[model samples]
Target: MIQETYPMTVGGEEVLSERELLAGVEDGLMMDSTDSVRYIILHCSATRCDRDYTVEQLLHDHRARGFRTIGYHFYVRRDGTVSQHRRLLEVGAHCRPFNRCSIGVCYEGGLDAEGHPADTLTPEQTDRLERLLLKLLRTFPKAQLRGHRDMPGSVPKACPCLDCRNVFRAIL
Candidate 1:
């Protein structure tokens, strides 16, 4: 099997591949302490696969919804660029009621071309999401990985559009 590589930018420097990202995670340079964290909830932007959702659009959309900023702690783009929109220690507005003790990770796309719920995670997104979750796990050993829909009190919606358990089965 061939090893797929993708570009990533962490802290302003461009990381050439997933290998380098893993190395940084191993070095514990990319994550902050989150002793209060009990869950790492995965989400999606609920956008069609053909559309591009930029950071500015996300901020604007969230702001329009009365959010102070992007609610998720991290936002992973289709090309695998992970943005730290909120700090690890900060309480996110994503996943209500559990925001104070959870880290919200949202991927870019979740809808198919016709605008229905589907797992539209690009290869780059899959890799980046996995690595990001791994790093978070290492930083907060007790934290459990969960889908937004899996949490109690979540409304009936396909926010993430996939079963994180099966997608990240290797690491989980």
Candidate 2:
């Protein structure tokens, strides 16, 4: 049978409630629920430096790039530390119009700044990422999953990683 509840626990405890992502706890809004979730965009940090940037750093950097928030709804760190960067309720800063509809979960690494494969997005991370995506898909049933590169003009070099798309496709 399909699971009813999504995975909300991290490090074996409730974590989603502990976030101040998006506006705050007071950001009163709800995403429209339907039998299907339309899209899931795959992305990577494209940084080869290895766990050098903190969540706050990413937020600051993206803001420097002129986004209102950190962009992605969730970020899976190198250590498998999942951070709620933006609320699933609000429109995200990730993929423009697609951000409003798609749930963006970024793997910590997959490609270097040059879009070349690196020793990134480890096996543990891959497992957790798959579990997280599967969980999210159940909650948002209309999740017609895909990648950022699949969209028009999404990257300078069809960025993110190479096999990341293949991975998502396998799961979806």
Candidate 3:
């Protein structure tokens, strides 16, 4: 049977809390004993809207690109199922230079049917993203939210493919 509950790691151990699992993180994952998180960056999978993708697939893609693991800390699927990819305490490969101080959360789909990059977040994806961001904000209270493309020196690309600032305005 398909697993109904997602699994999350807290202090390197698995926890079954649905909210934490669905948020794609646990408390300790976002912070280290000496590390302070400064930003939560949003990204997109850059996949066509008509298909569904998984964190495992993303892991393989990242590995193929020479990354040791999936770069994003969290992966939100089209159906709103959230999956944890990388350990939050580890620096991500999702963004350059700023990776050391940021958490990367990516949602599946940033391309339209015609294969052009677009804001392809489904309603379910949007709702889940909001909830996940809110939960993360509770942990990193002072952290700012930003789209992947908003980072300084970031190449010109609509990584998140949405107005992430406006989408998360109420919480930020």
Give each model a TM-score.
Answer: 0.79, 0.70, 0.77
Q: Which residue pairs clash within candidate 2?
A: 36-141, 36-142, 37-141, 37-142, 37-143, 38-142, 38-144
Top-down TM-score ranking: 1, 3, 2
Candidate 2 ranges with C-alpha deviation above 4 Å:
1-31, 34-37, 49-51, 112-119
CA lDDT of each prediction against the hidden true structure: 0.82, 0.64, 0.77
Cα lDDT of model 3 by residue, 101-134, tens digit: 7888999999999878898888898888999998
Q: Comparing candidate 2 with candidate 3, which one achieves the higher lDDT?
A: 3
- What candidate 1 gets wrong by more than 4 Å, as runs, is 1-33
Weakest lDDT window of 10 consecutive positions for candidate 3: 20-29
Question: Would you list the clashing residue pairs of candidate 3?
Answer: none
User: Model 2, 70-121: lDDT tens per residue?
Assistant: 7787888777888886666655666655655677777777666564756476
lDDT tens digits by residue: candidate 1, 47-77: 8999999999999987665565687889999
Higher-ranked by TM-score: 2 or 3: 3
Model 1 residue 105 distance off true place after TM-score fit, in angstroms: 0.4
